[model samples]
Target chain A: MTVTCPDLSVEIAGLHLQNPVMSASGTFGYGVEYEPYLDLSQLGAIVTKAVTLEPREGNPQPRVRETPAGMLNAIGLQNPGAEVFIDDKLPALQRFGVPVIVNISGRSVEEFARLAEMLSIDGVDALEVNISCPNVQEEGMTFGVDCDMTGRLTEAVCAATDLPVIVKLSPNVTDITVIARAAEQAGADALSLINTLLGMSIDVERRLPHLGNVTGGLSGPAVRPVAVRMIYEVARAVDLPLIGMGGVMNAGDALELILAGATGVAVGTANFVEPAAMHQVIDGIAAYCRRHDVARIADLVGAVAADQA
Target chain B: MPRATAILRHREEVVSGHYLLTLDCPEVAKAAQPGQFVHLRIGDGTDPLLRRPFSILLAQPETGEVQILVRTVGRGTGIIATHDEGVAYDLLGPLGNGWEAPAGGEDVVLVAGGIGVAPLIFFADGLRLMERQPYVRSIFGAANQEALVCWTEFAARCDEFTAVTEDGSAGETGLVTDVLAPELERDRPQHVYACGPDGMLAAVARICRDAGVPCYVSMEQWMGCGVGACLGCAVPASAGGYVRVCADGPVFDATEIDWERMKRR
Candidate 1:
């Protein structure tokens, strides 16, 4: 049977993507690491692991642990710093057909701006702000938890570069929409929700935490419900385009986020389980559109039924 | 490396808790080298969550098969030990750097504790094939005789073999290092390779250090992506920062590791 292909293309923050499937930050190393196992050109975007102003040693050993249908990680944002990343890592990614979204974290507002400016070179399509890092100036208050700080950081990053800025929200907050609106008002080009949920695991036999850092961010199939709920709420609350991700393992999970009002869906921890998972998700998304007779994948955004009948 | 769904060609319980699983995967078998490992998904589902890394025990390219040794240390290994034959299990392999073989006219010694003997057996079998290779000696240790994995393989391939156990179930009732220290003085084997528990590897690294013998060790850890992307399987390097066990070296020179820090774990 000769079936015509459905258009899986999407546009986030003015950068046109080949599809609606992307690699979540922190799960995909720097895009080049998974070259042997996956074809990078198949992805909508490649969100790299978080990079900081300087190289980070990360947490001590035992940085990860497997839970029920999920996993926890406390990698401490270990990276080769910004300058080294631009020189060493970013060069390899330039050859791919996919758009590159560099994820960044910082100790203060200026650090985030400097990183945004330094990465304003060619091949970098956009910036995904990782505001999960502690704001040392505020005595270690995470920016995403406070609306004011989130707004301030967003404005600073937006002003630093002409590249479209995407603010990634943490799910640990009481009300994620409050922070989402703040980023929108501060001139963020787009928003991505949610980062991993704050969680912990302990070993009863050893009487100690499973991760050396004591706590970690949980991601996998377990976080899908929370992501769907958050994306549903934020999509209604703000007009800015939303990129949804949390425990997305297959095309069905990605569609759930899209139907809930997400412009794009990013696969996180599944990259660790199966490197080719993103491609499967992309193929499935195309197949899904064909089966349902939908032409453009973007038409499914916020398509969830609001009727309780 | 291609992530292929390989059929479980055979499964056998070598002893009380140890298992030998042979998978029919031509790509992985042909590409695999001793000391490199594979990240295997326990099933087609997600309840188990992460893929487990196993040392490549044997890879027969001609037969289109690869063998992995597992000791039921926990729930993951327990699940893999009972895996049904003839079912396809997702596997990514021929990963990490394997050991480097010594040139001709060199005497070498091998050390294995528990299931760490898996890769050493493959290394020894390769050495036996080289016509120019000379004398080879090996030491096997575990809690008892029954836990001594691949003892028969080492005994048959090496010129000389010694077995030691904490409970005195095998040839000697002492540490493998105890035999190794004096053996270093007596024979002075030029190259050494050891794999075992963290404490045992630390001791072996130390003894080999004092005797002026160059030794290589294979490390194990709870890994996320065995492809070096996760940065989860990190071991402290003596040089300063952390090195990935999956990418840097599952097989590393003994001196490159910070043995003092590893023992703290």
Candidate 2:
């Protein structure tokens, strides 16, 4: 007897995917670093690290510190700038045969637009505008904190490139729905939430901050609940497709976000725990679909009962 | 590059708060090199979610075994220290740039302080496996006698081994640099390799610079992805910009590091 494979294909905006599992930006580096561990083509999409108009050296040492169930990091959006990334890194990513979503962070709306235009090349499939990097002092704040700024930034980025624009939202705000709605109204093709929550840790013995930056954005299992809540809220509030991520370690966690209304799911901190975690998640989702007798994996998106909601 | 499940073969408290864990992983051992490290998943679930990075202390491919020296510093290491023989650990390695083996017949000095001895021990072992043996001097220092680790194993292999403590408990009474200074002035070993705390490494780098001896030092930083993807382990380079320790060189030329900025971290 032959077993039928469930359909796992998903489309966000106009971008097609073999599956609905993509590696979150910053977690999976340029899609080439994990090549030795897993098949790159297996992923739905590969989101490159936060690229900038100018080369950024990032924060100083002790940039990461493990917390109870998660970790805090203030990498400050380190990248080789768009020109070098296109020349040096993009070729390696193109070899994978997977959709490449470039995540870009800018110090201003013009910078974001400039990056979007520069990265709108033949190989890039989408642009993920990172307006929520808490590690950077000046830039992320101006664009992400206020609703008008978020909308304006999203609008400028969308206008710069013909590629699908995905705005990544930060959870360190009063109401993430406001920013989500703003991005949606500004013609964002899709939305990814939530970027790491702002947090900090201290070394009591030395009376010093744990991270060199003193504070960092927290990621991992500890922030899963917050991610799900925001995704659920933003999905209901906005009409755009959603890409959800936060502490996604396995297939079960990926499904949790999909049920909450994410068209696709991303694996972040789990990449560090198991380099093959995205593959496992992709496989696990297929296995779940087969067990549940669901013909299409897309049926699982936002499948939670309205009464339960 | 192979991710494999390693079976625990042996575990013992090599030093007071440090553990020596041996895993029977043929794939990792076969691919392992000196100064490269393994990222180990500590807990079964996501509570202690991230994998901890540990330097490969010994990799014996023939025996299909690799050893790591773990210090019980926090929750991750604390949980890892409790595992017994027969437990399986999901390991991703051998990651990062390991030591570049020195040319044969060159005078070499290996300096280590506290747990910094982890990677240097593997480097020394690799030298032994080579066709020619160089003039080797190993210097180890700790807070006290009990804090010193792997002295016996290192002593058995090197031509001259010196263990020092701040309290004058065992071999000598001063810092490891005290011994490293005169050795640099007199013989001036062709190459100096070191691993330890930032202060110790900085001192070693300074001494090597003054003596005009090329030095390579292994650095440690809180890392996210042991692979270079997550730029979490950024170290300021002496020349200009920052370099990711995981990708660039956990082992770097002593002169490349910005010792002053590194101390701030």
**Recovered fraction of real interface contacts per model:** 0.68, 0.85
**Best-matching candidate per TM-score:** 2
The alpha-carbon deviation from the true structure for residue B158 of candidate 2, after best TM-score superposition, in angstroms, is 1.1
lDDT of 2 by residue, A1-309 (tens): 223699999999899999999999999888878888899988899999989998988888789988978999998888889999999999888888989999999888999999999999999999999999999988885577789999999999999999999999999999999999999999999999999999999999899999988999999989999999899999899999999999998999999999999999999999998888999999999899888887888888989886774
Clashing residue pairs in all predictions, respectively, total 1, 0
Of the native A-B interface contacts, what share survives in model 1?
0.68
Per residue, candidate 1 scores C-alpha lDDT tens digits across A56-162 of: 77777788889898998877787889999999999999888789999988888999999999999998899999876421223123888999999999999999999
Q: Local distance difference test, per candidate?
A: 0.88, 0.89
lDDT of 1 at B175: 85
In model 1 chain A, where is the ten-residue run with the lowest total lDDT? Answer: A132-141
- What's the distance in Å from true for residue A239, model 1? 1.2
- The 10 consecutive residues of candidate 2 chain A with the worst lDDT sum are A1-10
* Alpha-carbon deviation at B182 in model 1, angstroms: 1.9
Measured against the true structure, the TM-scores of the candidates, in listed sequence, are: 0.96, 0.97
